[model samples]
Target: MFDNVGYRPGRKPQNATQEAIFAFHVALRTGMRSGEVLQLGARTLDVGRRVAVVEHKTQRYTGKPRRVPLLSPAVRLLKPFAVQERIFTIDDADRDALFRKVRDRLMLKHLDFHDSRATALTHMSRKVPVQVLSRISGHKDIRILVNRYYRESAEDIAKRFA
Candidate 1:
């Protein structure tokens, strides 16, 4: 279900650098905020476990770190670049620029970097139960999740009524 064109054994974009595409794909797959994705050091990834230990940006709210599982596409994209000390070395400003530039060039309407995280949570909400998604998304409380994240979609309600 993941549209992993750039991340999975595909050619790099002509105008964009590999790093640019990589940052965006990682954001998409990991559900990491652009800032946290920028801060990721290579060591945070556990290849054996297929999880990334996020330096949770919302740690002050959640008071715990989060471990996000990586599917094969993400892991494949990571393996080659795994040697870099800082998984992503680009600064916040440049990171945003690259993501925006690619989004525009591809004509992906109304897309922004932060949408990647929201997209991830929305998709996962269907597959992962709220309790598990709370941990994955680092939501401080279930109410915060149901009240804010993925509020538009209620799969169970649809199924029940139908």
Candidate 2:
């Protein structure tokens, strides 16, 4: 949806649509859930270290903080918002409503807001080992990572062999 009509990448957001687009880009880059991205605050980001330590959904179960490695691309996108208390001002309900309208307009009704995490992990899986990906995703079970989020197509897999 970032490529859709309203999104303007690389520029500071000027309006609500641009802000939502920016949030989605953060989620895509950091492999963070929509709520996590919306809740992201300046305090959570460690730009010097290129990582963001976030309190995630699984934090209560594992009793460990989630450390999300921020690649250069993600850092660039996040730099402008580093001084703000909250990166994206929209709440989950608003974010959901925005995404719903975008998806409906874009004919992407099948897309879910949470799909960004899965998509990010799938792309990251190609560059990092499963163990590393597991760490980034905060998934204690490798099986969950493999079974649920690592969604490389069979055609893509065959291309690797070829």
Candidate 3:
């Protein structure tokens, strides 16, 4: 399901470059679900720690929040837009529309914005510790998370183990 993950959907409105890039950059760093990221409040970000404290979509029932580390690039991209209540001004409908327009324009097949989660996971799994990755990804089972998101070569995995 996580195949063909190269193209990241930019958050363009009417083909504008800057806004779209920022939106895409945020999704790329967080690995959060659309609902979770859309509702992510400003308080979630700890600038000093460069981390976003998120309550996983699945964790609404469990009530434990996870600490997701942010890339410096994403922090820079978000800093200008960060507000008192939310990081993104757009709602879910706007997010969906923006992502859909970008996907259609790029002519990508089956590449939904949600796939950005896999993109983030694949990027982080290579370097992040399993425990931390599980927390950030909000996946209680690392096997499912790794199997679904990461398609590493046997040699690459072997090197990781070594």
Candidate 4:
């Protein structure tokens, strides 16, 4: 499905399709929501520190800022546009439309951009503790992290134990 975007990793995004793909990559890598990923700017992202501290969904309830650790892949994706006020020029509507087009072409029933958060956190659960994953994901409740986001199949878990 992403093949239609014609985006090769490490290449600068040249068009809207490529930009949307890159934005998806950033969200996948950072575990950031689509809005947070789109809102990212040089002011919020610290490539040098490999972290992005921003006001996010749980900040209001938690009374703490969300600190998103930028993995190497995310750092590479953002480095090019780090100087810009907005990392991704793509807006919500454009992104939604672009993703909808891809979803339709690929015949995917549920391919929303917001799914990146669950996908990212699921992947992170394998390597990080639940507490750490919650921090990365800005989930105040560990139950939400384990029950909602960390979706590993029983077979997959059994294989790890085996």
Q: Which structure among the candidates has the greatest lDDT? A: 4
Backbone clash total, candidate 1: 0
TM-score for all predictions? 0.73, 0.89, 0.73, 0.88
lDDT of 1 at 70: 73
State candidate 1's TM-score.
Answer: 0.73
Candidate 1 lDDT by residue in tens digits, 1-162: 113224433433333344566777777776777776766667777766787776666677767677777767677766665556776656778877876766777788598777777777777787778898887776757887776657444675598469
| Candidate 3 to truth, TM | 0.73
- Candidate 4 lDDT score at position 3: 72
lDDT of 2: 0.80
Model 4 stretches with alpha carbons more than 4 Å out:
62-64
Query: For residues 70-92, what per-residue lDDT tens digits would candidate 3 score against the true structure?
Result: 77766765555454477566766
Cα lDDT of all candidates, in order? 0.68, 0.80, 0.66, 0.81
As for lDDT, the candidate ahead, 3 or 4, is 4
Q: Once model 3 is optimally superposed onto the true structure by TM-score, how far is the C-alpha of residue 28 displaced, in angstroms?
A: 0.9
Misplaced by over 4 Å in model 3 are: 1-21, 155-162
Clashes of each: 0, 0, 2, 0
lDDT of 4 by residue, 44-161 (tens): 8889999887777766787977788887878887887777787678887898788778777778767778788889888888888889898888877899788877889999889888
Residue 23 Cα positional deviation in candidate 2, in Å, after optimal superposition: 1.6
Scored against the true structure, residue 59 in model 4 reaches a CA lDDT of 67
Question: What local lDDT does model 1 show for residue 4?
Answer: 28
**What digit string (tens of lDDT, one per residue) describes model 2 on residues 54-157?**
87787788797788888788898888777778777777788788777887898988988778889999999989999999888878899998998889999998
